[model samples]
Each structure stands twice: as structure tokens, then as C-alpha cells.
Target: MKKSSQPSLLNNSEQKAALPCDHIPIRPGNFVADRIFLAKGSMTTPERVRFVERICALYPEAQLVECPDTPHNRIDLREQDNLARHQKGKHTLVFGEHKSAVRFSAEEGNACPNYWHFSPYGFCFYGCKYCYLAGTPSYWHSPAVRIFLNLEEILERIERVANQANMPTAFYLGKLQDGLALDPLTGFSGVQVPFFAQHKFARQVILTKTGQVEQLLKLDHNQHTILSWSLNPPELSERFEENVPTIAERLEAMKQCAEHGYPVRAIIMPLIPVKGWEKIYGGFVERLLESVPIQRLTLGGICIYQNAKALMEMKLGKGNNISQSLDPRSKIGDGRIRYAQPLRLEMYGHIVRTARKLRPDLELALCLEETKAWKELGIEDRMGHCNCLL
Candidate 1:
């Protein structure tokens, strides 16, 4: 079967095109492209042109494929052999997949929740050292922000689904990109929140590591949207996270969201092991209890994709030697790697116990784990969809 070559598309009713500026320089193996769509507020034409021009100059190897002004016929660009090169440690490309409203599930899974992930932007701007996306096919350059203008149609489908389902259905917003990071530029939440707010059966969750909560706070959040934040200890943030918000800032944002009566969840995932991690993580848990009234907390240990194991090992280098020493083996599908099950159980057990003591009513769960682990912890009853239910 021939692979479908549909480029991801978006509604761009608000976008305007600028004249081609100077040619941006690119090294031998880098592929880059940019398009200017109608930005929400105060985005001048010259500024947009300059931003595109600057990026082209920075990545000269990239091809500036211009997208159409009309909703249809937008260019669908693909990386020819650059992905293979990224496999080799050479040049990187910023590949864009312009998806339409009905076609949004890009991950590898048949059981993908029938949720619309309107990824306007292709890659994340924040450079977390342990970012899973970075290890995937997209991390050829400093993550670029690609916005899908056709969000209106995506929301329309969500509404249509909500009308059919009498019971509540949850949809995630930040799966492909930081849900709120691009809100300042796109104002997606302004449109999305109001749309979902009208549907009694629909609940929207926007997750992010960025602390740009002001954009979301401007809207009326009447328990329609749940603003979630991914969290880690200061030690992990400082050592592993790059170009992201501080833990204090994120927690403060959570406090603000909770105060506004919006249900908020915290995800302490990709839990990396380091020296004195127990002590540091314990303190971090204490700080979280003191900071906000968390609606739910999800725990996850490190699960590396097969392709990223080498890159991750190189990135961690000497810092992760301790983790390498206590290697534990487990398999998920055909993928397998080392994450000591005993150690994972021990670490997660501590977190679950501590969090339960801190907030007895706070819902707690794990991200992606086997059912046996839940049974081992004696919390099988709490496991549900995505293991975020309690």
C-alpha cells in the first residue's frame, strides 16, 4: 500500500502573507520552512516577516515552502532523507505535517483515544533535556512553533462528538504541543474554552510545562477546562529540563488555576534518578502539598523509546551512570529497555503513600504501566483510562 502523503492542514482565516525577504542561510543538511497565518492580536506584518526571515537565515538548508491563503490546497512538506540523517548525527530538519480536522492522531497506537490534538505548531520551543518528542522524528532543530490555522473545524468535530455522547467525554489539547504556550500567539483557548464550555458532556484539558497561565486566566474558566501542569523536582528541572518554566512558577500557576475553581492535575512523569534523588524528591513532594490543592496527581517512571535510548544515554552521560547500574528490564509491545522494576515500585510507592497522606481525597494514578504494578501496589481499583482515574 502506498503511504498517504497528506500534509497536515489548518484553517487560516486570520493569516496574511508577507513578501519573501532575504534568503536564510542553511548548512549542508538542514531543511527548514515557514508560513505566516493570521495571528490573533497585535502581530504586525513586518514583525511576522522578520521572524520568518530570521529563522530562514538561521537554518539555510531548510526549504521555505509557502502555504496557501485558502483553507484547502495548503502545502504538505515532508523530509526526504533528513530523518535518516538525524539518525546519523548530521543535519536536522524542521518537518511540518499539515493535518486536517478529521485526521489528527499521529502517534503509533490503534487504541489512541478518539481525541482531536490540533497541533498548530509542529515542534515545541521549550527544550527539555528529557523530552520524548526530541527523540522522535521531529527534533532536527531548536523546536520551532508551527500553528495550525484550521482549529475552527477541529473544534466543530469535537462539538459534534460531544452532542452524541450523553455522558462526559474528555479531550486533551496539549498532546502535540504545549497547550497554553502558543495561546499568547494563537489565542486557541479563547476560542476552544467557549466552545467546550457550551457542551455539558465535553471536558477539555490543556497540559503544559510552561508557566504562561495569564493567557488562559484571561478567559472565563467555569470548570469547563482543566489546566494541567507537568512537574518535577528542582533538581530534575535544573539538570534535565531546558528552556522551560521553573517549578515555583508552575506551582504558582496551578495555585492560581485552582483558586479560579478550575480542576487542575499534576503529572510527575519521566521521573529520572540521580544522586540523593530520594531526599530531593521527598522535599519536592512536601513542597507540592504546601503549594496547591491538586485535583489529581499521576506518577510515571522513565520509559525510553527504542530509537532514543542512545541519544538519551549520550545526553545523560555521567549523570545517569547510577541509573544504568540498577537496570531493570520490562517490555511494552515490541520495545524494551532498562528501568529497574523494583526501584520503580519503591520510588512510586513512596510517592503514592506520601501524596495520599498529604491529600487524602486527591486522585492519584500512573501514566503508562502494566496492570501488575497497580496490583502490586494494592491500588488496582484506582486504575482506569490512562491510569489517571482513581
Candidate 2:
């Protein structure tokens, strides 16, 4: 039979012109890079050249090194001269082509609706102790922040994949890095928010822990971009999350995005069970719902691979409650350690009940959890309502 000439169902949106590459703006502050390493092939495109020139203008003194391989090679180079020191803050900026810009989640039994994930940047500036990327191959090499200059090609890849798929799909930005952490420096939101806004079949959902929303507030997101924030209570934020935005700042950003007509969501994941967690977390949830009209709220607890667990232990010291709390006897679908089933249930249940009472209309879901957990939480019907999906 001949294939149908019709387009994909989700690909029915009108074609929109992309924002001019030269018009993109940057809000460079203390987050400027010390040096930049560019892949030789990236400079061939005009868009790539303009993006590089923009960065060069911001940090005139930073050295620019052209690598023989794509910038991905520079990030995968495990033997940086001063590896330990570079991971602190004195990091290098590497921009290159993203060869395979879109792919399905390789995670096993991740309850989230399977969709494509692509990042304009990788390995965030905010170094949370329990970062799951720590266990992945990239962390083994270098955790320095990376920004890709070939965004035009990346967006084209998304459009092509969405046109080919049968159902509606979303391109997630937070899986590989904190989506918006360095937005002030890259001004990526200005470009991406509008691209997705115009695309009919493809949608963009960004997740971040940073409060950098100055540029986002001015964008015409057109409801196609969903902005979500990773949050924790004040006590937990002060303890485990260092050098990241405070809860107040993140909540305020969420409020601004919601007010600007952007679909807003929150992921209260890696919900740690520190002492007095129930009362503390319950109160935190109450205040958050009161301050913002959140469209969705997802809950999750400690989920880590062995290597990531070791990295967290090394950074936080061996006796850290995060690793100690995991059930070591068995591994989950993706070979990651997590809190015992009962503990996770209690933690997820607490926040769910607390938020439900305050805002019965709010959508609640889980992250990277298994089928049994979803059934236990009685949210099996809402399985697809995750951070990565609409």
C-alpha cells in the first residue's frame, strides 16, 4: 500500500519564521565563562558564527580554542589538565554541533510518557549534590557547563521528528541539564520559546532550578512552552542544594511565568526525608500553592545510580541521609537506588494530600517512578501527566 501523503496529527501547526540569530540578547553577569572551545566545523554556518561572536563580545578576554572534534568530544575528554578545580566554577564553554539532536528516553520503566529530549546546553552551572547526571558517562569526564551554538539545526531536527511521529510529542530540555540556568548568558529562551510557540506539532517544556526569568517574562510563549521549576523546602534547599536559587525566588519565577500566560508546573522531586520532614514539607507545600496558581505538581524521592550515589556520598560525606535512606537490597527498573517503597509512599502521599486539600483542581503526578508506585499512589490514571509531557 502506498503511504499516506498526510502530515502527522501533531504536526498540523502553521509554519512560523524563526527569530533572527543576530537579535538574540544575553544578560551576562558573574556567570561569564573563563574560556571557550569551539569545534572547527561549527563555524561554517552563519548562525553559528553569529552566536560565537555574541559570546566573544560578552567576554572579550576569554581565550577561544578550536577543537578538532565536535564540542561533545571536549566535554567527553576525561583528562582535563585541572579536572577537580575546573568542576568548581572556573569552567570552559564548549559550543559545537549536536549530531543526534533528538531521541527517546533510554530509561527503563520511567512512568513519564516517553518523548524526545534535547538540550541546547548540557551539565548545568548549579551543582546539586544529588544530581543524577553524576552517575552518567558525562559526569565521569567533566561536569563543566556546555552551550551548543547550532540551535537552528537542533530545532529543525525536532520539527522533522514531530512531523514523522503519529501522536503529539514534547521535546524536554531539563533531562540532560538545568534547562534555564544559564539563560541570562545565552538568552536561549528568547529563541526557543518563540520557536516552539510557532510550531504546531512540536511543543517545548523546560525544567530548571534557577530563578533567571528576566528574559522569559518578555517572551511570546503562546502556551506552547511549559516552564517548570524543581523545588525543595527552605531547610532542604539550604542543606543539599547549594549555589542554586532559593525557594522564594523559584516560586516567584513560577508566579511570573503563570501570570505571563505560560503553562507553569513544579517538580518537588528527590523529596528527602530529613528530620521533621512531614511537618516541614507539608507547610512548604501549603505556602507554594497559596503563592502561585500552579497547573500541575509532580512528586519524587531519592532515585540514583550507584556511581551517582558514590559521587553524592563523596561530596556530602559518607553518612549523608540521602544515600543512607535508599534500599540497597534491590535495584529498580533502570538500575537506580531509591527509598524503600513504604518511605516513598509516605513522602509522596504527604505532599499529595497537602496540595490536594488546598487546591483540589491541581494536577498531581510522579517522576521516574515504577508501575507499582503509580498504582499505590492511585495516580495510575494520570501516568502521562509528568514533567516531560504537556
Candidate 3:
């Protein structure tokens, strides 16, 4: 369980009414769950009550389970064993209290430093085969998709932190899950974007690989929200990102957001070195630049956690390209396996060179790379301004 020490911004009078909970029409096939569960203590709060009412209205046929206790802990050993047996259940949703709603990380050696994120939802609806969450301790323990009901409290904490910073700080929304992947069901974007727009010191950065942006485009964002997309070549998307929107649809969504006066960015991450990758990536970048006015472009290659690497190898088969291409000399740091230093420089350098040549004014950065690697890519000066930051 995670706890935030930051004080709430709400007063007694302000807490009388619940925060906004507006329901929007979900894009078809955006989220389809067979089972829905609520934690026993979830209904004590008004936000949870409204969230439950919204979910019930959206999926009337889903079998709702009121869990006797929190799913993170088990009463006995036998129940824990049963959860281990059913790791692959499809279309399950759990609405619970996010005990650890806000997490602050100061990664000293990486590209994105001094970052904070909150989990309005856990895991993702879109099935990406190489997702790092699958190998994590939390996902291994309880792999079911979860949506938090304490969003109003979470945002209050974020505002307090941003006020303390006394600068134009960013509050990231897509670290633990796809930020907007389940928006069709949750309508979080509709509420969150407007809240950030009203704040004086904070901005919201929402990252997603999913192409659900109808709710976002309708909001009066006032350039306070940065709508970033995780993108890749068409061939890779079709092969790995099952149930996700196509590359064309994602590009169209980015274009639409840009047209709506929102600052847009793209992260071409987990850059797989497939056959003819250069030609594919080059063409994709060309098309992207021509289609949308991107504010920033961040590039990254595969950096998987050790447990996630083992799980991916198991799911993708031992003969998969991801496993076969991993450099044996690459040491594991922060419990993650990375490509060798030389290989990382080659990959990042290639993409950086290709992108800068096409658009010299493009803002480029790396994701989760060390200081030395940043210097090697000639982007060490632009360290803090990453995808999640301004």
C-alpha cells in the first residue's frame, strides 16, 4: 500500500459535494470486461459511490462482485494459491481504493528525473505482448485490471505538491497504466483535463498508445494538458500491440488533438531492431512530421525489468527476437535488463540523427537512459525536459 504525506487542499465546506463524475460515450470495443468487483471498503467515500454508479450504468450485464476484503492481501494460504492458478482471466474489472495513489521517484541516472505519478487505473486493457507490468511484483500478485475511486483526493494531493514546487511542474498520468486506455468507461479525461486547465502551477501529461481522444478534444485544455502518444511502425503495431488502435488511427488522433490547440508529443519507444527497421522507422517519422505539428519527439529502445524479461521470454517463446537480441554483457540495474551500452548508443544515435535531419527544430529526448548515454546522443543538455516533463 502507498501513502502520500502531502496535505489535502480541500476544506470542510468544499468536501460536501463530490468531485465531477461525468459519463461520456465510450468508443466501441475500447473496454469489454466480463466481471466487475468492488473492494469491501470502497463505498465509504462519495467518489467511489459515484464511480460504481457510472460503471454499473455502462456495463449492465457484467457480473459484479463485492469482495469481502482487499484483493492485495489474502486471509489464508489456500486463497492465495487459488489466485495464482487463474492468471489469464479475460475482461475483469476491479474498482478499489488506491492505497498508494501517489508515487514520487527520483531516478538519479535516467533521462526522466524527479518524476511523480498516480495510478487512477492499474494494468491496461490493450494487450501489448511485451508490457513490463506483467513481470512486476504487483501484477504477478494481482493481474486483474483495477480502477481507483479516490481520484478527487489524488488530484488534491497533486495540487498541493505542485504548489510547493513553485514552478510549472508536470503531473504524469500514464505510468502504471495506459492513461486513456479505459477513458471510454471512466471518463477521467473529461474531468482531469479541465482541473489541470484551471490550476495555476501544474500541467497534466497523459501518455497513451490507445487512440481514444474524443473526450479530450472536446475539453477547453488551454495548452495546460500535453497529450502524448506512444507510437511505432505499422508492422510492429500489427504484430505486438493486439487490441490497440492501428498506426493510422493513432496518427489521426494526434493530428486531431493538435488541431484542437493542445500541445502534442510522441514517444517512439521499445524501438525493435527488426529487419528493415531503418526504412520502416524513417518512413514512419516522415509521415508523422507531415501529418501533425508535434511539439516533442522522444525515442527509446527496449529496457525490460528482469522478472518482466523472463515472463516475456516465456510468453513470446524462447526463440523470440527480443530474447535472442539481448546482449549478454548488459548488466542488470534497477532490476531491469538493458541492451549493451554500445548497442544503445547505436540505436539512439541512429534515430536521433534521422529525426534531427528531417526537422532541425524538433525537441528530442530519451526515456530511462543514463547520463553517459545522453551525452553520447548529444542530448545531455535537454535532460529534464522529457516526455513526462515540460
Candidate 4:
């Protein structure tokens, strides 16, 4: 029923081979959609129906189903949770029409000046060992990745919310999902890039671990969007990260975004104090600063709730580096578990010292640490300049 841009005749094998080097591929992302579903309101319009059909076309052999109610309401938690830790993105799925997609974070006590975040999608598909979203009840019930079909309304809601603010505020997209992971398949960036580009008073911030920026490269963004990437060294990645692009690929993608005039930032977060971590991270910082034109670098250690820590234990054994590093005094800060103050200080200090030696003028901030930690690191004044804020 389509005229141009029909489904490709090539099969899965051919498609994988066809993908360019310098990138990693993921199912439930980047064009691999073996399972697809249409929610109650996904196909409300003929145009939307056509768009769904186009997305289905990319996965010619995928099985498509139509859900009667909400996408997660009917899913079984056992299977989805099992997959959450054992095999993420194994059988890629696409759920449609997320009704509640925007919210304001109310994090307090950790020196967090809360910000408004919105998701064009829900539930990231990448398999990271320390994924805090895995513990959330919303994602626990249905671990499938979702794409919202109500963009027009979402944008209108954003306008109303942005209008509430007297000054330009950022609506972040990486809170509940990797902002750009599904972009290669759904082409949502084409919608978001232009929307933020022309919005009256809202600026956009997005983060991802994927290396697919071909869609981003062709857009005409008027500096309204800030592109960020969550990163760890390849050594750490090999041990903890799965079903995502490599660090090299992500840096390459970041470089491309920077050259294309998108403000680029990096969050070297959940820093694991593995054996020889000092050398590994030190060498990596040198390479990162020398290679890319970064606007800012935010450093952080593992921060999560107890429920999420249980999920991490499931994926990684109880004796893992992260689990061993967790502060065991039973004193929780801001309702989230974290590395001890001294350990966090040591890890963050190493990165800060390394970065300062290379580029003293480089902008840096600590992510989700307490005020005292900031004061300890001598970056107390850079508190609100985090990844999500303006």
C-alpha cells in the first residue's frame, strides 16, 4: 500500500551486513523489530496508521499485534523481569501509545534542583547491569520498549508546561529512556529536532548510549537541543554493558554530533572502582579530552534504590565489584544507595584531577552527589549545572 520507501527486500542477515562499521546494532532498536504492537490509540489517524505500517515494513518478518488496553497492564512481570536481567533486547518489541509521558523530577536532599523531563518513548532496551529503571514497577511489569503515538498532544502539553516557566527551561528526554536509541528505526528525532528547534521557550536535552546519528546529522537544529552520551570505559563496558554500542562507537557518534553543531556532553556515571580503575579511567579521560570537543563532563558513581540494587545483583553476582563497593552501613542517603563518601570522593577526585590537568577551563559537574561531596570536590558552585538542567 506504500508508494516510496517500501520494506527492503533484503533479509536480516543482509541487513546486518549492510550496517556500516563504527557502530553497534541492537534489537528493539536500530531497525530490528521482531515483535511489534499497536496500543489502544496508536492508530487513531490514517497518517498514524501509515506510519506504523512503515515502521512494520522495516521488520518485514516481525509479528504485529494490537493491544486492547494499556501496553503494560496485561504483561506478566515474571517473564519480563527475567528478561530484564538475563537477556535484554533479545526479542525486540515495540509498544505504542504511552499516555503519561511527561513529569517533573522531585529529587531532593542530594542538592538536586529538580527539573522537568519528558519521554517520547518509555523503557530503554539496552542491557546494562546497573539499570535502575529495571526496578521501577512500571518497567518491571512490562519490560518492553514503548513509542508514544501522541506527539502532537505531547508537544502541546510541553508548550503549556514551558509557558509556566518565566525563563527557558529544558525538557529532558533521557530520564525514562535512552533519548536516541530507537531513533534509527522510528525516526522520532526528525520530529523532536525540529520541534525543539522552533519552540518558543523550551530547550531540549537528550542522552543515549547508541551510536546511530545519521538521522541527527541531517537535521537543521538551531542549537535548541543538547546531545549527551552516557559513557564508561570499554573495559568496564565489556564486564557490565550488553546489547549496546561500544565506547569507541559512542565517542565517534559524539564527535559527529559536535561537528554537526549540537552541544555535546558526557556523563561518566556509576563509576565502578574495578581493579586498576585508576589507570583505566585516567587513560580514557586523556583520550576523550584530546579527541572530542566536549561542552561539559559530569562524573558520578552508582546511585540507585534498594529495589534496583536487587536487580543489579541478579544480573551481576552478589560478589561483583559494584555490589562490593555499595555502602553497607544501612544508612541510605536520599533513599538511594551509593558508594561511600570517601570512595565516591576518591573516584570523582581522580577524574576531576585528570580532567583539570588536561583542560583546566573545561566545564565539569558532579551528578547526584550530596552538597558536602561537591564542597569536598571544590565544585560546590557547579551543582545545578548538571546533565538535566539548563
Candidate 5:
């Protein structure tokens, strides 16, 4: 199917003038909201409008509502009043808030996880059986893709921050949705990739399992944009990641991106323990290295979120052999439930060792796991945010 085309939310000056307030402080009872920057694109649909209205009704004290008409950018919610009220210990935002409130926590203080998450669109169009969004409140509704049109403003803010920091900052795109799933329809990468490339302090990393990357390859992009693809074995991709690109097709996209001078990365994440798992994953890694010039690779074992576990079981079938093999575990602060630490370390070690044997120079790291095990691997220094950094 052809991608949908909508008017650029940032292009409408009249709409910008009509927005209630650029910054509305919403404080519903004791729960204070983060400052919600008004992006013209945020009100693209009636549902989105209703969502915003409901949030406003709930919280009347969220401040810093500046409405800039940018295409797809990040709206910082940290500036809202009652910031302390929003946090019950570590969790940010109640689980069952609004459609737009996909729970996320900034790595405040300490070394920020070095991972950057930017979502222009919320939820996803592709319905992967293993998708974690299904567990969140937003997933209960039809998957209507909402593009945050104020992306340009968000980019400008990010650029400003990066300029002041003057360090290599990896901003993650596609946290709330697939980074490139809507690229063909929205043409965001065309504008965003180059923008980040121009800034020396920022590296734009997009993670996707989609093969519709022809638009990206055709662009004369700066080398700073790292095109990372999430790969699973063919069996898993076929069985779990329904309606997405095939493993071969994804690798082909990565190969094309690398060929076009874009630095490429790979993520062997949420690794499911299927039949003949080792041989399947090892072969997949070998095939990946054979196809793309992987600058860095992240190895992650399958980690499900607790809230989503039952849903995943139902979708994949509870009696299925693979589901039966998955053991129950605790949820990390990031919202993903994982296998036991020991088992995860073993799997990570195996993948890292196998990949290192093939390409000694290949940068390898782990995703959202204990740092101590990574340190023991002698590859500790290589660890950074979300395997996109090497």
C-alpha cells in the first residue's frame, strides 16, 4: 500500500495562531504534568485532540506550552509543575493516563543512559505479535499513527542543547514507534537526517525492522545519521514480526545504506530462543556481517514487559513451545521484563564472542542490562546508550 500523505503540521501559520495557549500548565489534583510544548502537528486528529483535552482537564498546572510549528520533534515534558508529584518513586506518569502518555523516564542525574529517544509518531502501524505497545494503554485502540508536527522545533531545541553540551550525543528516534515505518509517507528523515549531520555534537540513530528505506538511501545525507536495523532470525521474523520486512529485505536495506556512505549499525535484540537457536542466530549474525559494514552491533536476549506478557502469550499462543520456554521475570525501570540475569549474560556473551571472532573490530554492546557483566566481557568501555554508539 502507498504511504499516506498529510499536510505538514508546521506549515500552517493560521492554526498556530488558533492554538489555546503555547504552554498550558496542567495540574489535575496532586499529579502535576510536565510542560507540554504545543506542536501544531500534535492536534492532527480528533482522537489526539480529545486526548490533549482530557489531559488538560486532568492537570491544570503544566506550564511552558510554546507552540512552534515544526515537523517532527521532541516535546520536553520535564518543565511542568508538580514534577515531583508525577513520580511515585521511579515510575513516571501513571500507567493508565492518556493515549499520548506512553510512560518514559529520562535517565536523570548519574550518567544518562547515553540513549536518546525521539518519537514523531506514537503507537505503530505494523502489528508485530511481540510488540510491547500492546500492553500499554494506547494500544487498546485502533493503531492510528499520529505525527508530532512540531518536530522542527524539537530538532531546533535538540540542536541548541547539543551545541551547548559540545559532546557526541546519540538521540534515539522510534522509541514510541518504528523510526522509519512512516518515512515514505512523512518524508521526515529527509529533513531530520541532514539536520543532525550538520551538528558535530549530535548523531541521529534510527532503529527499524522496515525495508522501506529507499527514500533515505537516495538522500545526500550527512554521515552522522546512523541507520540501524533490528534483526532476528528468519524464523522469528516470519512468525513473530508479522507484516514487517523479511530478514533478507532488512539486510538488503542495511547494505544499501552502507553502500550510500551512511554509517550503519545492527541490533540483534529481543532474541527469542527458538528451535536450533544457536545455529539460527549464529548464521543470522554471519549473514549480517556478510551483507552490511556494521560499525557497531548490540546483542540483546528476549526481554518481555510484565504487563504485556499475558497479551504476548495470547497473541503468540500460550501453549506454543516458544512461549512455554520463556520464564517469568521482573520488569526493568524501562518497562521491559527480561530473562534471568545469568541467562541473559550467557546469551549476550555467546553473541558477542561469536561476532567478535568474525570481525574483531566490530563494536559490540548490550541493551539495558547490568553493566557489571558487560564489564567482565573486557568490552565494557565499548558500552554506551542503545548499541547505536560504539
Candidate 6:
């Protein structure tokens, strides 16, 4: 599909488009979950009960369990990271409530603008081989995917934060989770998109790998929502990304969103330096620029927490390219393991130049690198435009 400079259809109305979801996403992105668990007090309110019932109906075949005393984040077993176990647990879905969902970023040292973010969904079902969430505190104990039932309260918190700010503020949805991975089942986008469209100052930004955008094409976004995808070249994705959509498939979805009048953006992130990387990456960047009408393009390399790195090595072997490439000298500013400064500079510079040479007008930014690195790469002034930022 070719991209148009202007949106083919205006989405600021209730009019729906006859769009197809040709993209396959996540790990069984259209998940028929193995089991569904109702957490403690998950059915307290009528609204909460109704939402649970709606999701449960979608997976009538899934086993349903009632957890009377356990929170959704906690489980009785330690979910092992073996390939077999990792894929198995990803299908486990839990229903719970997070009373407070809005939080500010703490990435002060890593050159981040400290954006405000929220997650109606907890954990991810897409089991990437190098998933950083695997090592985070929330997912370490239990890696099962969850849907937060207190969405109304979460939206209220977001509006409260937006009110505190004098101008338009963005509340990110994919910081802790792939924003739309489970949207087909939860229908969260149908709720959040309209909320942001009708609100005065709140803008929604969703980062995702899912291509089930039928709900988005039908919504009245009013140009208030920004959809970004975590993209990698198909070659590298095959090595790292498991059970996620291909680069071409994501670009197709981006084209549809652009045609339907939604602001689109992408991140070529966690760039792995495979053999003949220059040619492969250069070609990929050219295709990306020529394929989608993206407002911004962000680039980043792998930044793995120690625990996450350990788990990654388990899947890719101790001598994997990613693990071997880590700068043994020391960790970077964010205290995450990364390639040597020079190697990162080389990779970032190559991709940046490739993107700029094709679409110099395209907005650019770096994700999760030190301030000095950005300055050296000559894009320090454009730091805040990265994925999930305003």
C-alpha cells in the first residue's frame, strides 16, 4: 500500500471505514488466552463486573479462576524463562485493578524529558527474545498478562494531571505495556481514544506492535492521538522479535492509520549490528520513509537491565551477538547494559544519516541514551520528540 501525503478519510467523526486488519501481531496477538483469572475484589463494582463479563465472553473456552486473596501482579509460582515456559505464561490473562495509574518518568540521567505515562494493561503477551520487561520487578515474579479493571479511575487521574499543566499534555500508554496488544479483547482503545478526543488538554500516545486497528479506524480521534510502533527490520526481528508482526505488516498498518487521519510515528529501536548491517539498515530506512507518512522517527539501541540481560542470554545462548557485543567496560548513564560508546555512536549515526538523507524533513530523536551521546550525534536539541514523549 502506498502512503498519501494527506489523510484519505477524516476520522474526527463517528463514520467508520471498511478497513482490513491484515497485520498479525504479538504472540498469537489475537490471543485465545489459556486461562483467565479474576483477582481479589476484581468484581467489586458493577462497572468492573460488567467489563470483566465482556472480556470473559470473548474467551468462553478459556479456564476461569477466582483468586479471593491474591493481587494480580503476584502469583504462587516462579515463571521460569525457558523457551517453553515463556510462551506458555504469556497466554495467561488476569483481571485486576490499579487504583492509581498515572506516574511520572524517573529517567533523569538518561536524557529523558520525564514524561507522564499510564498503562491500562499490565505486562505484555508478545514474547520478544530480548524483552526488558522480563527483568522488571512487576514481571519478574509473574509474567502473565493483565487487564486493569479500574479504567475510569485511571482516565480521571490522567485528566487531573492534564489539568495541572497549563498546555496540552501527553499521557503515554505503552511505557509499561504494548498499548494495543490486547485491545481486540479489552476494547480499551475504544474508551481511551474517545476520552482524549473529547477532553480539553489531554492527548493520548500509544506505542504498540499489534495491527488490529479496526477499532481505531472507526473512532473519532480528532488528531489527538499519536500511534507509534516499535519496529525492527524483518531480518533482525526474526532473530530478536518473536511472535510479532513483520516490518512490512507494521508499515501497512501505519499507512492505513495515515490514510484514516491519525498521526503516525515509528521507532527503529534496539538496533542489533548483524552482518552487512549498513546495507540492510539503509534499505530498511529507505523503505520506512517511502512507505508511511510518519511525523517523527526515533532511533535507539538495546538497553537491558541486568536481570533482563541474564534472561535474554538464556534464550540466545551465552555467546549470542547481543550478549557478546555488550561493553564489558561498564554500564551506561541509565545503569543498563549497552554497547561501547563508539559502537553505539556508529550504529546511531548510520541509521540517522540514512533517515535524514531520505527524509530530511522528518522529525528525529534518540530514545534512552545519555545527553552527551545525543550531542555527539548532533540531535540533542531534538531529544524530547522520541517515542512516548510529547
Deviation in Å, model 3, residue 81 alpha carbon: 10
Per-residue lDDT tens digits for candidate 4, residues 273-344, read 999999999999998999898889999898888777887888788999999998865234577788888888
Runs with alpha carbons beyond 4 Å of true place in candidate 2: 1-20, 23-32, 68-70, 75-90
lDDT of 3 by residue, 116-232 (tens): 887878877776767777666777556667777677777777777787776777888888788888787777776677777766777989899877678788889889999899998
lDDT (Cα atoms) of all candidates against the true structure: 0.58, 0.76, 0.74, 0.76, 0.60, 0.78
Q: What is the C-alpha RMSD of each candidate to the true structure, in Å?
A: 8.9, 3.3, 4.1, 8.6, 12.6, 6.9
For 1-390, candidate 1 gives per-residue lDDT tens digits of: 232232211233322122213223222111223333222321234544453455446544544444334222122233334333333222222222244533344433222224444554455566565556656555443224555444544565665555555556677766656677655444456667755565566677777876666656766766878877899998788877765778888898899888877888888977767767678777898799888987778778776664455555556664563346435356554353446777778878888787778888877776666666777777776766442221
* Clash totals in order: 24, 2, 1, 0, 27, 0
TM-scores vs. true structure, each candidate: 0.73, 0.90, 0.89, 0.88, 0.70, 0.90
- Residue 149 in candidate 2 has what lDDT? 65
lDDT by residue (tens digit), candidate 6, 303-348: 8888788888878898887888888664766688888888888988
In model 5, state the lDDT of residue 17. Answer: 16
Model 2: lDDT to the true structure = 0.76
Candidate 4, poorest ten consecutive residues by summed lDDT: 16-25
Which residue pairs in candidate 3 have backbone atoms (N, alpha carbon, C) closer than 3 angstroms, thus clashing? 2-100
Residue pairs in clash, model 4: none
lDDT of 5 by residue, 173-283 (tens): 756667886565445676676666556676777888777676687666678788888888888788887667788888888888899999889888787776677788888
| Candidate number achieving the greatest lDDT relative to the actual structure | 6
lDDT of 3 at 47: 60
Q: Where does candidate 2 have its weakest 10-residue lDDT segment?
A: 1-10
Instruction: State the lDDT of candidate 2 residue by residue for 129-148, as single tens digits.
Output: 88887567765566556777
Poorest 10 consecutive residues by lDDT, candidate 6: 16-25
